[model samples]
Target chain A: DVKVTQSSRYLVKRTGEKVFLECVQDMDHENMFWYRQDPGLGLRLIYFSYDVKMKEKGDIPEGYSVSREKKERFSLILESASTNQTSMYLCASSYRREDYYGYTFGSGTRLTVV
Target chain B: AQSVTQPDIHITVSEGASLELRCNYSYGATPYLFWYVQSPGQGLQLLLKYFSGDTLVQGIKGFEAEFKRSQSSFNLRKPSVHWSDAAEYFCAVGSSASKIIFGSGTRLSIRP
Candidate 1:
């Protein structure tokens, strides 16, 4: 079965700490995305990469950055974690420009910044 | 800008009851519609999707959705819902482009 795997299921960090959330997909998909899900707000896109090393900001990319150095790996970075950044982060991948194919998502990482 | 709307924040239905979850979208041109379900602490799973051809699409787990371009809505339905079907449902819209916009989601609870 194809899968998008997230490195951590849960993480707790102190304020001002740097954080890294990693995602890896085995499907060889061309598009990778990062989204933060909050209660009542559903999921908001943080960033997405169409190709390796190419990243685009999403609806809420203010406190986040991303790295896609390899085809199968995409990493979301938090420059300085704040309490407001605490939320569930999900990573997803899909075929390029083919929204009809839908997306395969990771189990997600719940980050808590204290 | 593309957007999706799931009006109900939460819904409670009895087991073996027929179910329907509402979804609305706003997008330019033809839109690709999708329905996904997320169990507790699990990733979202694709329930169904509508791109072209038939307006009604069948999905896994006895779920179906109909695409209504005139109303800009894609509503999901099931003849009978099971206890295992209790989960959060998300409606999403996308174009031929690379991004998809998701709705706030509707949490479904099954009653005995």
Candidate 2:
């Protein structure tokens, strides 16, 4: 079955450390997104890419950046980790056509910043 | 601004009983509506979606949702809920754009 794979399921990083969370999709989807899931807040979009080397900021894009070097790979970067940044990070992918079909998500990477 | 609202933060229901989770949306036009379930420590799975045509849509695991344009609501219902159905349900709305707005989510707990 097709899937979105996140490289890490859990991670602990120190404050002020640079962190990288990787995601890869096998479905050849053109759109990829990163969202942070928090209790009582649900999931909030951080960034999304519609094509390679292209990215757009979502509702909550502060303290985050993204890279799409290849069509199948999208990476989320934390310039400097903070305690507030600790949350369940989810990666998802979908077709270029908007809302034609729902997104396929990765198992998610829960990060903790100390 | 487009947004989704799942008013109930938590719901408890006995197994083998009927279930309903409410969801409402506010958008400029007829939007794409979806219901997603996230089991403990798992990714969100699409329960069902409504784009157009029939207002009522069937989804996996015997779940269904009905779209009421006049009410701007798309509520999920199940004839009977199982123990395995305990999970967090999120309601979402999407426009013709790339992003989808998700509600805060409702956590469902099944009682014995």
Candidate 3:
């Protein structure tokens, strides 16, 4: 079974603090993604990594950065956490394929920026 | 760029009633489609997917979806609704490895 693990289930941080959301996958998938889910906006992509040390910006990547130093791990970094960044963050991983087989997502981390 | 649209933001159904959630996608070519359900405070789970061949696909937890090429839609349906089926459903379209889009999502509410 494929398991994606997110380090934190819930987090509270003060404004302007640096926040790190970590994710790890056991499936050895080549693609990993970070997304933030909001009520009306839905799940918007923050960043994605196709391979180790390679990263791509998603639709909403301005306030976030990502690191994939290892294949099994992907970390999302908030340079300066703000109250607007408070939301449920999700991590997903999938095999590189022409046909989408869907992603294995981790239990999201609900971050509260005060 | 690929995009998805879920028309309904929320739906309410009584237990044992039939339910359907609408989803539409816009892509240049034949696209990969998927339906995912996320329980409150949990991760999203794959409900179903459509690649090719059969337009109708069955998934976990008694959920199924149909791919309509002409309509550019992939709607999820269930014959009967259960209380545990209450969750947020998202429809997604994948055009390429880097070009996948998810709909805003439809929140389902079940009443007894």
Better of 1 and 3 by lDDT: 1
- Give me the TM-scores of chain B across the candidates: 0.97, 0.98, 0.96
**Model 3 vs. true fold: TM:** 0.97
Per-residue lDDT tens digits for candidate 3, residues B34-91, read 8999999999998988888999999999999999999999999999999999999999
Worst 10 residues of 1 chain A by lDDT: A95-104
Considering only chain B, report the TM-score of model 2.
0.98
lDDT of 1 by residue, B26-111 (tens): 99898988999999999899999888999999999999999999999999999999999999999999885378888999999999
Per-residue lDDT tens digits of candidate 2, residues A43-104?
Answer: 99999999999999998999999999999999999999999999999999997755468888
lDDT of each: 0.94, 0.94, 0.92
Model 2, C-alpha of A66: deviation from truth (Å): 0.6
Question: Docking quality tier of candidate 1?
Answer: medium
Off by over 4 Å in 2: none
lDDT of 1 by residue, A1-109 (tens): 7799999999999999999999999988999999999999999999999999899999999988999999999999999999999999999999776546889999999
Error of 3 at B24 (Å): 1.1
Model 2, B15-90: lDDT tens digits are 9999999999999988999899999998998899888999999999999999999999999999999999999999
Q: Return the DockQ of model 1.
A: 0.72
